[model samples]
Target: MPKQKGNLWTTMWISYLETCLNNYLYSGIWFQQFQKIIIPHSQSSLMTKRLVAYFLINKVLEETIRGDYCKNKNIQEQADPTLIPKTIITLNQVEASKFSYIVGWMLFKLIKRDYLMNSHPKFSVICILLRSLCTEKVEYDVLETKLQTTIIISRSEFVQFMYRLESLVIELFEKHNELGSNILRYVENSFLTNLHLNQTFIQILKSSNGENNSELENEDCKFIYERCVLIYMKSRQKTWRSVNNYIPKKGTASL
Candidate 1:
């Protein structure tokens, strides 16, 4: 049994080396000096299991954007703005969920750095990108906490963030009306499918001690809800027809 365990460890070591060689070979780096490590004792079961694990991790990476941003904690308050270029590329390659998280974290770091440096324009283009990345059903604890912190860093900074965010919403709506509608529909479907959105909203309202800002409640809220219900009806025609006829039109709520 001890010998068998040793062999397994040996295989793991060999696997890591192979992974490195695979990368180097593809890059054509150090090819001439590289000595090939032969798999003398092939262990199919072990290799297959590890391969499966790799695939799962890779899927998460692709779905979660390789976790590059979170993995590299070297991001400093005074880091180069040039990092945005790499971040953009990484975001484009990540899966939607992973990408959203990465964008959120990056925005948090930017806000933190900006606060430390006393920058007026903390809510820059990158900050806008962060909010845009937030899905209608976003639930990142880190993001929510940081968002509250950033907003409270100073009254003026909070106001600026809200103002900039409002501008961003308007700009996005104007720039991509059709696309925005579709995206909203998608978000609504997710809410309905999960059976948690309405409940969550209720909780939020309750937590506000019923003093929920009536100011933020506007025609847009009604429009958003109606749009979601309409989209829901379309997809669930047969299942929801009876209730669909009872749904209120735009600018009204039924509940």
Candidate 2:
């Protein structure tokens, strides 16, 4: 079992290296590399499963951002400003929808297992890509679908995910206010429909009671707490609400 896991890890790392090369080379070598390194072990390991998702995401993003297909005048005019090289090609609505489904399915699998922590290198890469996707209006459906499908089976892991997500949301808002607002709206809508998620948020809020734990005192957690309050208000209006009580006072820390 250990040997199998070791081989899987090596294959995934090699695939990632090939992806980086493909991103620059774009010489059709990635397909050949994938066939040799990824296909044989594809059904045998967790790392391979994630590598498949990562490869798909990389392919989709590459095609959407720099593919020859996006060179048409009409599509060029609609390119997302936040993504680098504004002159590059952008995905159309249909492509955006397909991309979203792929990401949503990936997140569904990731969140269901505790194997990937928020600090995992590949997990962080996934988050960065998701954040970049948020820059494109056409990709909002994918973000929304991810939120709708995400399940919080573990409180700690869920809290970590929220911390990462809040940072992405704030960064998006800072870069493009309208896009940020739209993403938040989707989150609000998703939270409203997923009662269990709301309850989980409330539970986290309740657990933080006046403690000075290092995790809660971190800047990411502080900002996440603030955002949680805003989202909670939008989803449920109640005079008795006290989640805001957890928000650190002014001058408490620099966020």
What is candidate 1's lDDT per residue for 120-205, written digit by digit as tens?
Answer: 33234323323332322333457556532222121223222223322322332222233321322332333333323333322332
Per-residue error for 207 in candidate 1, Å, reads 3.0
Q: Which ten residues in a row have the lowest lDDT in candidate 1?
A: 82-91
lDDT of each: 0.34, 0.39
Total backbone collisions, model 2: 0
Model 1: how large is the Cα RMSD against the reference?
A: 22.2
Q: Which stretches of candidate 1 lie over 4 Å from their true place?
A: 1-195, 205-212, 216-255
| Location of the lowest summed lDDT over 10 successive residues in candidate 2 | 246-255
